[model samples]
Target: MAEVTAEARIEAPTGKVWERLTDFGSYGEWNATHTNFPDGGPETLAAGSTFTENMKLMGFPAEVLWTIEELEDGRVLAIRGKGPMGVIVGTRYSLAEDGGATKVRIDGEFTGAAVSLMAGKLKDSATAALTESLRKLSGLVA
Candidate 1:
């Protein structure tokens, strides 16, 4: 398995940051791995809601069928997905109000036979991607 986490303190309130985070229409603006939502972003977000996302990671493109696993309005959003080659992916976005700003953290996990072959590289790439994503997200809402 491979795992990565990235955190950033955005100069924006939790509500504002959460709004941008869940705005799947504008996801590509800040999410580094996002290519597009083939059928468009989810119309409503709720546990068990599903969506298809095209993404690029480690220089390879993949389509994932994702299910929303958790939701907490302005506090959290977590999803798990199935990708090519029997790979399973999970991502969690967590937010906390710190002072007057919002502290956002993204945690990602990868598992399955495919991951064993390139766990280290996947970790590095995902870490960088998450960091870049957080930077872009902060810029947009800060």
Candidate 2:
């Protein structure tokens, strides 16, 4: 298994950030990473809530089927999914207050033949992409 983690401090309150984070329904609007998010009613996102999103990784079409594994208000969110191409992936998002800012961390685990072969480069790309995505999220909510 290969993992990559990225953290960013945003100039926003935890409440504001949480709202944006949980607004999965509108991810495609401002989220640069996801291109096509499923059209569904609002999701409560408790354990077992499932979502489907079509996105791109390195400009290649990727479909993700995410199921909420855990949730802790203002603290943690974890989701797991698997896709074609032998992909097994998990994502975790955590948030904490730091003075006047919110510290957000995104950690990802990917295990697959294709991922293991380029683990090093994937780590670097994940770091960069997550950082930029967080920055964008902060800006959108700021």
Candidate 3:
């Protein structure tokens, strides 16, 4: 398995940050790995809701079918997906209000036979993408 995480303190309230984070319509604007939502994002996000997203990572494009595993309004969102080559992917977005700013963190996990073949490179790529996504998200909301 390969795991990656990134966090940032955005100069914005948790509410504002959460709005942008869940606004899948504008996801590509700030999400570095997001290419597009093939069937559009979930109309309502709740545990068990499913969505399809196209993503680019490590110079490759893949389609992932994701199911929301957990949701806590503005606090947390977690999803698990099935990707190419039988790979399993999990992502979680966490937010906390800190003073007037928001502390945001993204955690990603990848597993399966394919992941073992490229764990190191995948970690690097995913870490970079997560960091870049947080930077862009901050730019939009902060």
Candidate 4:
């Protein structure tokens, strides 16, 4: 298994940050790993919503069928997905309102037999992607 995390203190309000975070239609614009959503993304991100997205991880293309596990308007969103080769991926996006800005954190976990082989490389690539994604998101909203 591989776990990765990244956080950023964005210079924007939580609502602004959340808007960009949950804007699935434009995910590829700010999400570093996103390529496209072939079947489209959730129009509403409430719990139980499902979406399919194509992404790249460790330089390999993967299609993920994701289910919204948790959602709290502008505060938190969590999703668990099944990727190729029996890989299970879980990701959580959390937002906290600081004094004048919002602190956003992304935590991701990968598990399955496939993950054990390249856990180290996956961790490095995923961690960097998370950081880059946050930077892009911040640039867009913050």
Worst 10 residues of 2 by lDDT: 33-42
Once all C-alphas are superposed, what RMSD does model 3 give against the true structure?
0.4
Which stretches in model 1 have alpha-carbon errors above 4 Å?
none
For model 3, the stretches where C-alpha displacement exceeds 4 angstroms are: none
Sort the predicted structures by lDDT, highest score first: 3, 1, 4, 2
lDDT of 1: 0.97
TM-score of model number 3? 0.99
Q: lDDT tens string, model 4, 1-91?
A: 9999999999999999999899888899889999999988986778999999999978899999999999999999999999999999999
TM-score of each: 0.99, 0.89, 0.99, 0.98
In order, candidate lDDTs are: 0.97, 0.79, 0.98, 0.95
Residue pairs in clash, model 1: none
Clashing pairs in 4: none
User: lDDT: which candidate is best?
Assistant: 3
Candidate 2, pairs of clashing residues: none
The alpha-carbon RMSD values of the candidates against the true structure, listed in the order shown, are 0.4, 1.8, 0.4, 0.6
- Model 2, residue 19: distance off in Å is 0.5
lDDT of 2 by residue, 31-136 (tens): 5557776655236779888877776666567888888898998789898887668887788999999887899999988889988787887677766777778878
Each prediction's number of clashing residue pairs: 0, 0, 0, 0
Candidate 1 lDDT, 44-137, residue by residue in tens? 8999999999999999999999999999999999999999999999999999999999999999999999999999999999999999999999
